[model samples]
Target: MRSILIALPLLIAAPAWAQGDDSELWLTATGEVAVADKTSIELESINRFSDDSGGLYEIELAAGVKRSLGDGWYIGGGYVRVVNYSRGTVTRTEDRLRVQGGFSTDAGPFKLSGRLRLERRAASTGDEIGYRLRPNIKAALPLGKSDFRLFAAHESFLPLDDTDWGENAGHDRMRNSIGVSWKASKAISVEGGYLHQYRLPRNGRTSATDHALTFTLGVSL
Candidate 1:
């Protein structure tokens, strides 16, 4: 398990390294609160810095609620506000609403999960309401009986329709991440990882790729 985890990033990153065009850093903080026996609320903040954008380029704040259906299945919905910055100035702002369903199950020593999400997005720079679909999958392995776990995840972004702002009607981008998470206590946890994002060329746009170092701090209550 350890050896596989160590090699996962290298193997996944080989093609990305050859095609990556930008470097970035991403930081995120999230909090979750149990509101009922099978329901919880979550809040997240994400900040992204990009070499091409000169500095901090994107910021996202999101709030969501999740309801467990028992038997490792769940449903969730969320609203997100995204702000794009360029050279310390705000360039565009977007509002997004998403609904998703997912399932998680234990497969031997590995914990596996997958989700399918649909999103409706409105941006300050565009008149059309963009629709998107996202499919994500993740796997995690516990490191002995310790407080740490190794994980890998992949997600694809598919635009359901063309938008004036930039979203084209087709396969958009995908993200692949490999990381380690440490549970600091019952209430707090931390994660760090490498993420590679590749955007497919569509509607005369050139393909682009970004390599990012990602970190997250999470809290639960």
Candidate 2:
């Protein structure tokens, strides 16, 4: 039998953009408890910047809208905030704003969706960055009593640490993951998988890498 363990992240990832006008409002509250092998990525000099970089626990609350256009394409925008209380001493608060465009359709028992994210972020260190997250494609399959899905995603993070000067930090990150989804019921779904993420090096340094086991829960409004 196929594993039902990998099911949450991909299911909720793009349903918000499956089609145009499918749902005007979307809401979901997911409480996930996981052990992060690494706390944070190492930037450059440690004395200049201090972060725990240890095991971590995270909780995320997300709510947004999925608007579909008359054509097969759709566009969506929303804000999600995450509060991280690390095992290490540092407490981090992250806020993200994204606008996404996608195309969706169904093939027999499965549905396919794709999206791109344009974003800006302000880090706790008071660094603001502009970047793009994309190639986030998902496919949902119906398997008799339950459902399944697959996701492929790549996210890039840019550094705007120096708005004061034209000199840029020139840093970006990329993440690649693959997982499966199980529709436990209308109200919830469970998913977990392996995520390979690497923080691109900047200013003559090596890259930081992480291979993490990710679990996500999906709920409906």
Residue by residue across 181-210, what tens digits does model 2's lDDT show?
667777677666555567776766567655
lDDT of each: 0.91, 0.52
The C-alpha RMSD of each candidate to the native structure, in angstroms, is 2.9, 13.1
| Top-TM-score candidate index | 1
Model 1 agreement with the true structure over 70-131: per-residue lDDT tens digits: 99999999999999999899999999999999999999999999999999999999899999
Considering only N, C-alpha and C atoms within 3 Å, which residue pairs clash in candidate 1?
Answer: none
- TM-score quality measure for candidate 2: 0.60
In model 2, where do residues sit more than 4 Å from their true spots? 2-52, 57-60, 70-72, 84-88, 107-110, 127-135, 140-146, 150-153, 156-171
Give me the displacement of residue 220 in model 2, in angstroms: 2.0
